[model samples]
Target chain A: MSRADTAGSGERMKVVVTRNLGPDVMPLLQERKELDLVVWPEDRPCEREWFLQNVPGATGVIVMLSDKVNQELYEAAGPTLKIVSTMSVGYEHIDLQGAAQRNIRVGYTPDVLTDAVADISIMLALMAGRNVRETTELVARGDWPNTAWAPYGFVGPQLSANWVHPTRTAGFLGFGRISKATLARLVPFGFTDCVYTSNPSSTPNPAADAETARTYGLRSVRRVGLPELAAQSDVVFVLAPGGAATHHVVDAAFLRGMKSTAVLVNTARGTLVDSDALATALRERWIWGAGVDVVEGEPHVGREHPLVREPRCVVLPHIASATIETRLGMATTAAKNLLGALFGEAMPAEVQM
Target chain B: MSRADTAGSGERMKVVVTRNLGPDVMPLLQERKELDLVVWPEDRPCEREWFLQNVPGATGVIVMLSDKVNQELYEAAGPTLKIVSTMSVGYEHIDLQGAAQRNIRVGYTPDVLTDAVADISIMLALMAGRNVRETTELVARGDWPNTAWAPYGFVGPQLSANWVHPTRTAGFLGFGRISKATLARLVPFGFTDCVYTSNPSSTPNPAADAETARTYGLRSVRRVGLPELAAQSDVVFVLAPGGAATHHVVDAAFLRGMKSTAVLVNTARGTLVDSDALATALRERWIWGAGVDVVEGEPHVGREHPLVREPRCVVLPHIASATIETRLGMATTAAKNLLGALFGEAMPAEVQM
Candidate 1:
């Protein structure tokens, strides 16, 4: 008797993957005989109408940050949409209320991309502070003519061990998972003090926050006001979420308070900072430099962008979670979440209301 | 005028800064009116004739990597060349033997660039392993024409946190300050084991290494043979020095021994690895990917470079110490070293041969 004859045929379930995933991750779903997977072939964002049509008969949908999962999508997905798993940590695009009301489990990959994002954040910070783009452009543009030795040419801020002395400190605007991860990366660079401002939450616990800081080897991690954070920090990181509560948190006043030798890194969200204010600060030498991943308005960012035009500003395409491994892990997790919900199992990483 | 009258003119010494430094750093040196500084006016490598002509009467020379401080150049400066300070951590171009023979103290910037290099190493590793370049190229080249959903299109490796389980270990080719710092960054991501291969001269006492590992919250820090490091490590880093003792340390044999999911990072030097072998390994899937900063023949690197053609290879233009702050610090330190040595004071970071 064949092995196939020994195993009884189970009912197959339809799953729609809304975006491209990793090659290795696809085999995991493809190998399952009881699952039928429909994959989109394009590399860019999927059309809303195409998704609306395809998702109607599907048991599960796997998506990414570009795809918005709202009430319309949920309604189009109908009763068969048991799971909606996004291959990203943040699910702001997903209508949580719709999922909750429909009794459909919501799965979003979190923590998976922490290292990748943290890595990019530090890269952007270093690149922006160091004038990497300017130097690279100098080489690329073949502006080598008249190149001669001069003092104070192409110099960027230094993250010296001396900067972590008792008098110096690192600051954060909006402390979260990525900020903590970034702090862990900066610790070895001799960062001694950390002052951060987090949004006032209903659940207030100072001891837990203190304990978390201690665990991460931070000498001090105090939650302070925005003004205090700006004044004391040698390097200020904007790592808060993008929403009405924290929009333009780092304005002109905060930038002016920073040390002239200080650096600014924003990897969380672009709107968390006032780009025009940052340009003025850099132009006026209020702060040393700025590194930004997400700009106030991205993709639309052109040569005319104020930060791009500024020599001290380092602008990168919003690619914090762009690493292959992290993206793949995110895809796999998303796939597994969809499969779990479809097969009547607990979703691996579900976002509850 | 009264203070100037009190100060003596003989205290002023002739100093030639070989490269451009930060304006802030220069002000610090300028604060010492006792030093007569001759600063370079351009950002390129200094002309050899200009250096020779200027050096005859100077007490010290602050140089960059582009400037070769050889025996001939030293003799031209005569008895006046008391110190030769480089604005870089690596002093290979500087003739250590000649400096030692002349009793000329040398100063180099080290330890300062450790965090920056370590940070870049992690960036390259993530970028390569995760297919950052290829995906970025895809987006930049406008190859992303359609917006359809496809499974397994642009997925890359994600050094999953799961790999840092008790059974898994992260290995290093050379365990030095930067390696230790890199390990510290990886610990929070769940890396447990820390095995490294170092030269016999720098081998740590087994007990001390273990204790250090414990202090850093690592499961263990053990020394092993090259083969063992290759066989047991989940991710092997080529962080050893470049000279004769460790050339092509990571070759086909080492790559063959690594797990298929493992990654290799080389931020130390290009000669430490075999580029051809690495390209072959990546192509054959012997190992996952490689992140490299230094190429065997750098500056001459082009699009046709073997690693550049490989999708899994992430090549950076030797930017380990490219951070603005670190570079500025190095330049400042070099300037300080020159000023201090010329004026008969202690060098801030002198290289003890």
Candidate 2:
């Protein structure tokens, strides 16, 4: 399609926001005089049929991580769709190839949430390592009436001291922007070595990895296989992108390879870890503990989730980027990206072809 | 009492533990067979009469910060007390001069809690800065149904970004072990300058302060007055000791001097801050927010506390040294101190007379 045809065919650019982004982001579109906005009123997921019907006339759509922007949606939306901006740092929900074929300019809020997510990752690690939830629950439930001092009654590893241990090692699965930031935060806690396995790019560079490690004051950063990462690490952080290519990467073999004193932290995606395997690992004490920000089929997660029921597992409701400051900054950044793209200006974080 | 008289006068070496300690600590005395240990059964404050009664026979007493080991208690003990081992790092509760005159050896647990307290200090700071309490409450109460998207809703400051503005600075009320550790953690988050005030010690030297700052990779660390610390700091952290010398140091004047965008974090002692003044500061928005682990008269703290009701103030139960691993290590260390002092062995951490 030519530029003139695409511009003339537009029947008011319709944008659908799958879930309520609150006023912090909504006003950015409402204030725009040129665009027409349609919002999902309910907090629940938008129906597939409703989304498909709504997308036919839309030139751009602002979606959440929960919304799946796939080939069918791209075909249904047809040639009118020019951009798909997700209000998240990760863009795994959108099919990259489909978007590429359709020439859809993808914009995601990255780096804006690096600090917030990194902070939460550390919080979860501490909470899990310290048994904050269990202890707090004990105090809140008034169970202290029968409590007495006992050896090893309630104890979790202290990350700082543990990091300094001679045997301690850290592992990152698919180390990228956020993992690097997380490593930076964990460095002072005495993490001496790091090994990561990410999806191989066309060309591998040793200098890039070395520079990244130096930036975080890491002693060493080496690329390794999954088995080595699991076997050697005291704390193995699952930070890989979520998709079919990396789904359920942390299986029984991987968990079994981890030391009995090891901890696992997953801030990347729920699908990256096999829920059943992780639950078993925690229940059976294959690893000391696990801190999970995302669980398989989240938002539907409730009391019955294996992680939720396990005392050793600290489960958070996908709050890695839920900080108010980060969320607002992200919303504004996404808005700027959308507005910039629409006006033929440079997008702050545009998906490269 | 001379050494000969003291050695022969003991019926049984009576030891009073002012609060509950680990079971392992009690067993050390039980195993000796020559010691009579009087343990506090409840978490409540030990009555003055009860403490006095126990002190009369106490050759050694294990006390917490809540107990005041003053001259009166010493006089009541009648020269029987030979040692005072405090479970905490601070010694403000003990009357140093009174103990010194009687040649009482004082032992305290320090350096052991540096990592634990530092971890909690960062936790509280992040929790307060990110509105963790409110957000968690929102999820717990199932308030997502009524929530709306706002351009800037529920946003807190990110520590990773440039937090220092011309009008914003980071201040420390006491530049000690925990504060130094906290400073090291904040270095990755872009804190360039730090100002602190410390009580004058016998040997006045700024060398320790300079060395600490340099070790943490901070650009500058300088001693300033209380008013200057309050006026210049964007985030004022209270790690100062609590006593008449530094009681309610962060009063109305200090809060008033703080920038509107500033935050206050108190993990040291509740008495260092004026509760009423802090409530007013938060209610009136004198500063952005506050994260308080210690409140005035804790354990007695309920939902009715002024800071608890305030949205901006994040009130946590005193869990600064509450990490599972740290607490366990502390329990074991405290036990070692008791056993070591009794058997005349070298204690891993001992307070000098």
Best candidate according to DockQ: 2
Instruction: Please provide TM-scores, in order, for all candidate models, with all chains considered together.
Output: 0.78, 0.81
Residues A196-239, candidate 1: write the lDDT tens digits.
88778745568977897688666777888888998888788888
TM-score of chain A of each: 0.90, 0.88
Per-residue error at A8 for model 2, in Å? 8.3
Model 2, B168-286: lDDT tens digits are 24689998888888888777666778898888663545787677668877767888888889887768889987878888989999999987767899988889999889999988988
For each candidate in the order shown, give its overall lDDT on alpha carbons: 0.74, 0.74
**Positional deviation of B55 in candidate 2, in angstroms?**
6.2
Give DockQ per model, in order: 0.24, 0.25
How many clashing residue pairs, candidate 1? 24
Q: Per-prediction RMSD in angstroms?
A: 5.7, 5.2
